[model samples]
Target: MIKILIVDDDIGICKILQDFFEFKGYETCIASKGKEALDLAKKEKPHLVFLDIGLPDISGMEVLREIKKSDPTVKVIMITAYDEEERIKEAEKNGASDYVVKPFSLEYLNEITLRKVYKQLFEDLRTEHQELTNTYGQIVFTLARTLEEKDPYTKGHSERVSQYSLDIANELGLSENEKTIVSHAALLHNIGNMSLDDDILNKKHEFTNEEKEVVKKHCIVGYEILQILDNFQEHALIIRHHHERIDGNGYPDNKKGEEIPFLSRILTIADAYDAMTSKRPYREKISSPIEAVNELIKNKGIQFEPELVNAFINVLAKKQIIIKENIQ
Candidate 1:
């Protein structure tokens, strides 16, 4: 049986969840305060967590963070009052597996707990991945073209990155919004690369300190270009920070982990994977598909959202999407 932990400040809510989930064949653990909830969760190690946003001892987000930190595999569903859209989004961003608006019917709750939450999470992850891609695509073409005139040797690099981005985005079952932003980000990830001297771009040799510095600035350059466009404002962070290192060693600004927006992180996985797998102007080696995915998984949380890395894996396993060459 599935083990579920219900954490709500209200005794009534705890009773409600216990009865409902137990009736559905789940073993249930109940806690009426956030502190107790955290203690119970640490002890019980439930398969799923149903958490209320309002708690007596600590805020729900605080509890959620602690729970995930304790055991990153447990899926947490935030239970919030109907008017808490801001809280809900915060929960989503803060590693929440799903959220349920309060005053929901027990039957609906049961169904969501058993079936709907994972689907929602998968869809949302995919959507964000796509949106980031599309946002990057809008700016990279010009940068790639600029580089092409001077380097000639790396004519299709950005375009190929765009293609690889699309493939991975679809493989992840990314939502329409995610595919859109990321496609654009992939295309423009090299905006800074365009400004490097032709000798450096087409050098076919290890980059000098100065050349590498010039190449690393594309992330910031892309961010600057898109930061001003209408609707582009939404994806500016992604463009500016995609190249950031997981260990805070990557170029431009060294923002690490969650400090980097999800869009930028998503693009980093797609861009880095493509760069490793596809032939590049200066590098010609290609990793096997399995090898590429393993590399992405190895970098999760440090460089990508752990959930996204898992979802990307599942999407590939399920093969649940189709990709068309043209975005129209």
Candidate 2:
């Protein structure tokens, strides 16, 4: 289990954060003063720390400095008020991983904490192993499952996408290495959604233009998270462009047609098919498999590559044990 240290003079805030983190399966320790926090930092050796900018006994900045000097490996996140921009900057200079402002949402805190912790963990694993292994794949799937837990509508979504993507890869006679890339990319493509706020993710109404733009950042964020790993660079790039369209209209970079990576195009079709057939918060009803296939057919050559769409439909037919006779 992950261990966390919460240092704040505010008893209520400490209690609240302690309860929340504990409930989320993290072992937590709370300190009401800067000195106590430092002591805990030495004794507990926590994986992460949430240190407030203000403490009763000593300056939170001093405590931060002390913690970094004593154990530079521990990740510290400064907890600050909205106006302490300079202090936040200084804390960053002093080796704080990140900072969260006061009046923060628990959901947002959880998201950032998980991102940082996992990022650090992945980096550590990379240094030790120096190559991809079953452990790495399990960690990737764990991230996917963690996102699904936050949004019930997406339960099993990544697994289905992986299966579909693999099917498409095989249908197209991709090399074994290419199939492995497709599988890993499919599993982790939506891992960026973990960074999105729960409000936007669970909203029952269609997103506004601004909200859509915010959501699109997930692709870039996903890429950043995975690109740090040594051999996962291709998977990271594939995840980043999975949202791109065959036309020149896709987001982030808007690479068009053959400019977009071919594997990303395969993932695009698989992701879209599963999303269409699954229930979503904004959609009133789910699209039947046939309806979803027809939608893919309709969008082919525009949103998706025409040949990949046809191949995906065939993959679906084999699984559903039916022909595509109804899917013009």
Candidate 3:
């Protein structure tokens, strides 16, 4: 479970925040003094801290500096009554993750907390890449789960897409190495969504053209983030082109036809099928598996490669994963 440290001199504010966060399923520790806050931070090693600028003992700014110096990974959100620009700058300089003034809304605070926590978790995952081996799939699944936790609408989306992609790879008789690459790439296809704002991600209304452009940037972002890993260079390139169309009408780049990577084509079919059938915030309801498959067939040779789409449909049929009556 995630732990939070609340450091404020106001007894009432501490009580309210502690109760609110605890109710939200976080383990919280409270401290009214800078010395106590530092001690708790050192002992508990909390993932997040809500600190007041006006501590009775040491300056909260000093505590922030001390905590960050000890462990730069610990996120600190500074709370202050004054909205002075100088103080805000200083807190940021000392590694504060965010600043909240008095009279802040708990809902807004929770939103900030969630964003910081997720951002930190992604960073940690990236660091863990260096230690990866045969356990790579487990680590990738953990990363996907963490991403889904942040966006409830896409829960199980990555895993399903990965499975679909693997099925296609197997149907095409891909080598074991190729299948591994396809599986990991599918699982991490949306890893870039981690950088998107919660508002844009969870918007219930249709996205504006600008929002669509912003959303399209995820492909590049995911590629850039994954390319740095030792053996993920190919995965990065495949992810970068997963949105490209067979006829040249897709994504960050407009690579057309056979120019698009083969694994990426497989991922495109799997991803589009899952998106069509999955519940989205803007959609009234999800399409049936048959409807999704028909859509894939309709778009084949245009949005997706014709042969891969046929192979994918056969894979679904053979696995009995779709409704029998729906297969035509």
Which model scores highest in TM-score?
2
Q: Over all chains combined, what TM-score does candidate 2 have? A: 0.59
Instruction: List candidate 3 segments past 4 Å from native.
Output: 1-142, 323-328
lDDT of 2 by residue, 1-328 (tens): 7799999999899999999999999999999999899889999999889999888789989998999899777788888887677877899899898888878999998887669867986787676675455467578679878888888888888888999999999998999999998998988999899889999999998999999999999999999888877677899999999989998799789999999999999999999988988888988546878888898889888999999998998888988834678766
Tens digits of lDDT, candidate 3, 37-150 = 999999999989999999998999999999999998888899999899999999999999889989999998888656876787678767766557336645655766798988
Clashes of 3: 0
Which candidate, 1 or 3, would have the higher TM-score against the true structure?
Answer: 3
| TM-score on alpha carbons, each prediction | 0.48, 0.59, 0.58
- Candidate 3 deviation (Cα RMSD): 18.1
Cα-lDDT of candidate 2: 0.88
The CA lDDT at 303 in model 1 is: 67
In order, candidate lDDTs are: 0.74, 0.88, 0.89
- Please report, as a residue range, the 10-residue window in candidate 3 with the lowest summed lDDT: 132-141
Top lDDT prediction, candidate number: 3
Model 1: CA > 4 A from native: 1-156, 163-175, 315-328
Models sorted by lDDT, best on top: 3, 2, 1
By summed lDDT, the worst window of 10 consecutive residues in model 1 runs over 319-328
